[model samples]
Target chain A: MKLAITTSGETVDAALDSRFGRAPKFLIYDVESGAFTLLDNAQNLQAAQGAGVQAAEHVARAGVDAVITGHCGPKAFRVLSAVGIKVYTTDLPTVAAALAAFKAGSLSQAEGADVEGHW
Target chain B: MIIAIASGKGGTGKTTVAVNLALAWGAPVWLLDCDVEEPNAHLFLRADSAQQEIITVPVPQVDMARCDACGECSRFCVYHAIVAPGTKPLVFRELCHSCGGCARVCPRGAITEVARRIGVIETSEVEGVTLVGGHLDVGVAMSPPLIRAVKARIPHDGVALLDAPPGTSCPVITAIRGADAVVLVTEPTPFGLHDLTLAVQMVGALGLPMGVVVNRVGIGDNRVHAFCAAHHIPVLQEIPDDRRIAEAYSQGIPIVEALPEYRALFRQLAESVTALCAARRFVTQGDGHEHRGGGETELRPLNPATGASTTEGANANVRV
Candidate 1:
């Protein structure tokens, strides 16, 4: 099963990133084979302010079963739910711990953040 | 008469027509700038407003003292304005669209609503024109409430020109809801035509009498006129791209003020608008209660053949 993992850095063990466009990278983890590939998100943020949606889209298009992040905005949460991506929130500093929590079905979804209108 | 001036797209000189018309009428006319998000009518009118009022909307204010963080508000909120699943709920003011659904469903009654001031509407008099406009506080998300506040102050007997927001959105809908007529401004560009269709659909849905005012008429294609012809919507006036008009706008003056020769043109536009209002025939709904409160009354059901079979709740007033 593929997983959309939002991270604060290039490595898998870094903190979960919540800020929309500033997150350095996102790791797409393959749980079944324990394989992973990192996709650079710095360039995508330039085109869209809400990188969370783009990150969600990347994993959803890859047929991911879940999303693990520190925080998710209201719009991104809606998009993720529409695509069948189960959202999980965690204090786990690394992507590996997020996958472990997912395997145990112990991951808690983050509180949905508010997003008024787009100015 | 309340006359709303709208443009299908941005930068179509909707404000220009509204300001000029208000000035030319020379009555106690109220100029409502309903484009709250980026209101620019003030830039042209330059009115020194004395009466200013802040506009607010009711939003859910979660009470932390009332006990459990059951997360019901978060789950129920479609926009996710409240998130208090664990501890006290964090209300993100930017994302709250001011829909009162969260407050109504709160079982604990912890979600009492509070008024949040998002913008200010002011009234001023400039050279005999009563100018009313709104300025959205920076970073405010909502605008419809502010538009409503400004419109409520319109003088009933004079020409009320509403400078509506440029779009087919909720704010635009709120601005033009009860207008007697609408003057749609547009240019003759491909983008202009695309957005004009959207505006036309919106106006048709609202069932309002409308006409077009083509600004900068000779600059682009005649596709706008062609579309109007196809739809049987009349083009009431054509404005040329004059450098003199541009100069006047830069100086924050109405065309009627800067160019005395153009006063007659605006007067004619006002006359045409009044004629349109007179030709409308209003059919009141069958609820038996008068809609306009006081007027010569007439009731015409939508489908006379159905008669009593038609479910009529409120009388529909037909005005030509």
Candidate 2:
């Protein structure tokens, strides 16, 4: 299974970005291979509005089964859920830590957006 | 000729000036209330609407049966109103700008336009003055389209006055875009002067001839007067800070109708505006700048020392 994690840096040891939409980068991790790839989210970081929706669309197109992030806005949450992408929240320090929490089934699944749109 | 009454600050008497000017014209004139968000001129005029029409903008509707979510529509939309995550695209109608880029970029022809009503325009007449106003639907964020719809009702001949929204934004631009002249109404306070500067910059950017009407005079300092003089902007009219005017306004009575003596003042305002518009026409024609018509021109901030027409200066100061 593949999962996406919002990160502030390119490496797995990079700190987890609290913001889902304006995160600096995204790490797509493959659970089986234990490998990850980086996806740049700089375009959305500069978006004046609707950054969350655009970022969600970006991750959805990458075929990620789940998303791990500190926060998700209403618009992004709606878009991800509509595409059957499950969203999980975590305050873990780094990408690797977040992935470990997900593996242990300790992350809380978001039933709705964790934050309001435009937050 | 078409004249637009605009103010940078709210509650600066834009509606008061527009209504009184239309009434004072004493001819079959058109008064377009382009402030669709909070149109108040209709309350004062009490015109009987003869025609009404709904204003709408086109939004995209996707056909899911086409069997492919190419993500072209989402990628093409600058506003992010459309998002294609899987086999279907989600459309958020409120954020749509109706640019139709998504529909045009779709290769499968799966996207079609659907009209979404955002506002209504009504035409009415009161005492020989035709009143046309737009009322935006609640929660509708876009108002320029409705303002355009109301402006389209303007006739080719005779005079028309547009009561522009009180701000130097897109909606205000839409209201005053093609006017022959603009009257910026403002008070005498510091806030009034600050906003008046913004309003002057906007009209100057459009290269339209503009003058100032200082409402509620004698209540604040003369900084507004000094600014106008320094910029070579004409101070066409000054309405004193009379409690009676406010009393009359609260009762939905136009000053011209309430006092009757103020009619001559408004007439003088009309004459001054005509003269200013004529002078602008002459200047543009003589300099061969009329052909540019709302196009790129030099922009500079108003330097009180210059004391010349700052139209080009204002145009140059525009950031974009």
Candidate 3:
């Protein structure tokens, strides 16, 4: 399965960014192959408004099956769910740790937005 | 003539000046409240019957059947209002600027324009003065289009007084642009002085003749007066800090109505504005050339750290 993780850096060991919309980078990891690709989020980070929705659009376009992030806002959550992408919240130190938690079934699926829009 | 009353700081009496001026001017006057975010002119004017019309902007709607989503529309939009990730394009109406560039750029003619309501404009007559105001929908960020709609109702022959929103942003620019003259209302406090300078630069950049009305005098130092004096900008009127005015304002009764004595003062203010407009027209005609470049000198950058003026020749040819 293809999964996207909001991270502060490009590597798997990088710390998870708390902000899904303004994260510095996103790592698209193929769980079976253990390979990953980096998606730069600089444009959405500098967006004047609706950064969460725009970032959600970008991640949805990447064909990810699920998203692992620290928090998801209402607009981003709406867009991700509309594309059938499950959103999971995690406070793990690194992307690899979050992935382990996800595989162990410790992470909880977000029933709705975890934060308000523009948060 | 169109006269825009603007202030860089909020609660500096833009509506107070506008409502009283409309009331004092008697007939053949139109009061346009361009502060769509918080329109308060109607609260004072108390119009009998207001007619409201919805204002909308064109947003792109894609025809999925025509398909080919080559992402042309997404690429053409500068505001990222449309995004085509897969074979389908998604449209975000809130971010759309209604430039119609996406619709024109679509190769298959699949993109169509749809109306999205952003706000409404209301027009009514009160005491012989026509009041036109705009109210933007809550959470809607786009206001310039609605402001333009309110401006369209301005009559050519009568005097049009526009109460612009506070601050020197896009909305304020939209309100004061193309006016015959601009009346900048400000207080004497430091914050008021700081913003007044910015407003002056904006009006100067637009090449419009402007005058100052010092509201709530004696509250701060004379720095604002000094600044205007140094720039040769006319101090059109100085309204004292009176408790009765505030008392009347809180009750939604115009000062001219509560204190009939102030009627003559407002009438004099109106006459001075008219004379200023006439003088500006005479100067423009006498020069035999448009004053297109007169305002460029005042557009220089100011040192924000020191709060010092960097502009030179600010008063050259700016007078009416």
**Best by the DockQ measure:** 2
**Model 1 error, position B275 (Å):** 1.4
Candidate 2 on B143-241: residue-level lDDT in tens? 898999999999999999999999888889889887888999999999999999888867776767888999999998999999898777889999999
Better candidate by DockQ, 1 or 3: 3
**C-alpha lDDT of all candidate models, in order:** 0.71, 0.86, 0.84
Model 2 CAPRI quality: medium
Kindly report which residue stretches of model 2 are placed more than 4 angstroms away from their true locations once superposed: A1-48, A69-71, A89-106, A114-116, B48-50, B285-320
Which tens-of-lDDT digit does each residue in A1-119 have in candidate 3? 99999998878999989889888888999989999999989998888776887788788888899999999997677678767899999888899899999889999999999888677
Model 1 per-residue lDDT tens digits across residues B197-219: 77765665555667888888778
Q: Name the lDDT value of residue B183 in candidate 1.
A: 84
Q: What DockQ class does candidate 1 belong to?
A: incorrect
- Candidate 2 lDDT over residue span A1-119, tens digit each: 99999998988899999899999999999989999999999999888678888889889878899999999998899899999999998888999899888999999899998787666
Worst 10 residues of 1 chain B by lDDT: B300-309
- DockQ for all models, in order? 0.08, 0.62, 0.39
If ranked by DockQ, best first, what sequence of candidates would result? 2, 3, 1
At residue B240, candidate 1 shows an lDDT of 82
**Candidate 2: pairs in clash:** B298-B316, B299-B315, B299-B316, B299-B317, B300-B313
